[model samples]
Target: MTNATAERPLHSVSVAGIVVREDGRVLVIQRADNGAWEPPGGILERNERPEEGVRREVAEETGVTVEVERLTGVYKNLTLGVIALVFRCRPVGGEERLSDESTDVRWLTPEEVEQSMKEVFSVRVADALDAAAPHVRSHDGERLIAAA
Candidate 1:
């Protein structure tokens, strides 16, 4: 086997992202655990793919079905010990549903997301908005915020 494949160490595959609408609204979910607003997402389980993680998280948190369009960016937060993948997706279908993980879900405009400086966010959101280009991996979630 190639060294790359042989040396493929275990990784935490997680997925999450900014859900957007044709009206320029971005989906943000208020985390029930911390009351912080963020794009809906969660970690991928064993044998699970990042795409599945994003789809499952979005559905669980927002009751919205989403189709991941493209990989916007990848991030690793040293402070939180988390590695996350962020994608650009559109709402496919579902009622606005809330869960223990998310207290609320809303489609906010860019201005609204900026005003939401109440919490640190992923910059991948901004990058996704600015360009569909995929970003390299990061070691900090704070870097994800700058993507905005």
Candidate 2:
């Protein structure tokens, strides 16, 4: 490998699940680390597939088992170099409970999601809810900065 290639910064990939129930409520968690309300997810392990990572993260944070439907959005945190793959999923089993990573877990309506979450996170849920093709967006960790 070239010296330049070895010296380049590395980016981390994360997987998130926008778990939706039949009544249209979307699942969310209040992070224990920062108390921010967002979808349940975390850094993907190198050995796991994106879908598997999503299921594992959601279950770990929210105690909810999900059936991944499809990827709904790709979000990049420009400042952190973290690429998040967000998926639309259905809750197949399990119950809502908080873990060490999350302080609270709840199923919220789309409006509640917009009201409670930051723009970067709310957009992920909104995109998953929409029937259009998956969205590609970038954010500065708080607000959206670009779209494709």
Candidate 3:
């Protein structure tokens, strides 16, 4: 491998699902670790596909089964070097329940999402809800930063 490519630090890849219901509510989880309200997701497995990771993460954290619709946004945590692939999904089955990763699970309206989640996370939901194009954004783990 080339020295430049081999020596660069590796970035962690995470997958998130914005599970929207027929009534336009979005599924969200209150994280047990930090008590932050965000969509259900986690680090992608080494060998897992992005869509599979989304379904697995959503199910694991929120106990909701989802069918991935499309990639809604690609976000990078500039400080953490985490690349998060956020997908827009539709709930197909399963019940809402809490897991070790989440203390609470609830479906919220779009307005509630904007009020509840941090800018970095809320923007992901907003982009998914917007029917334009998938967004590419960078954030400092919480707030969005200007594109470079």
Candidate 4:
């Protein structure tokens, strides 16, 4: 492989947990660096399984332990060049807490969430809810993202 290819972050498989509660509220977090409210997620650490990564990311970001139920959807973002997997999950323990990576965390209703998102989060949210054909989805969704 070329030096550039060797240096490239190896295509990694990461998982995100959509931990929504009974009240139709979805968990969201404001990242410390970007200040954007988004689902709690992170890249899978070396030798870690995707499901474990999902649980760990949720706990690390929100201080809430989550039980991953099932894989909801798999998506790729061409512009970002990352393969993302979303899962339906439920928090089993822990309380609301923020980590160094995040500045805030909260659960909001669908309508309430739309107004709060700084960018296109609805598509990701839809992938999380649309489980009928849950599988790998390509970055084609980017075509729908409004240009900045």
Q: Flag the better candidate by TM-score, 2 or 4.
A: 2
Question: Per-residue alpha-carbon lDDT of model 4 for 1-148, expressed as tens digits?
Answer: 8999889775656777888887768898998998887788988788888899999999999998999988877767666776888888888899999899999999977776777773345556666666576755565433443333
lDDT values of the candidates? 0.77, 0.96, 0.96, 0.78
Error of 1 at 47 (Å): 1.2
Clashes of each: 6, 0, 0, 0
TM-score, ranked from best to worst: 2, 3, 4, 1
Candidate 2: worst 10 consecutive residues by lDDT? 139-148
In model 2, which runs have C-alpha deviations exceeding 4 angstroms? none
Please give the lDDT score at residue 36 for candidate 1.
80
| Candidate 1: tens digits of C-alpha lDDT, residues 27-126 | 9888989888788888888778788888988998899998888888777776676777888998889988889898888888887887763423646567
Sorting all predicted structures by lDDT, with the top scorer first, yields 3, 2, 4, 1
Q: Give the lDDT of residue 5 in candidate 1.
A: 95
lDDT of 2: 0.96
Q: Model 2, range 9-31, lDDT digits (tens) per residue?
A: 98999999999999999999999
Model 2 Cα shift for residue 145 (angstroms): 0.7
TM-scores, all candidates, are 0.81, 0.96, 0.95, 0.82
| Candidate 4 minimal-lDDT segment of 10 residues | 139-148
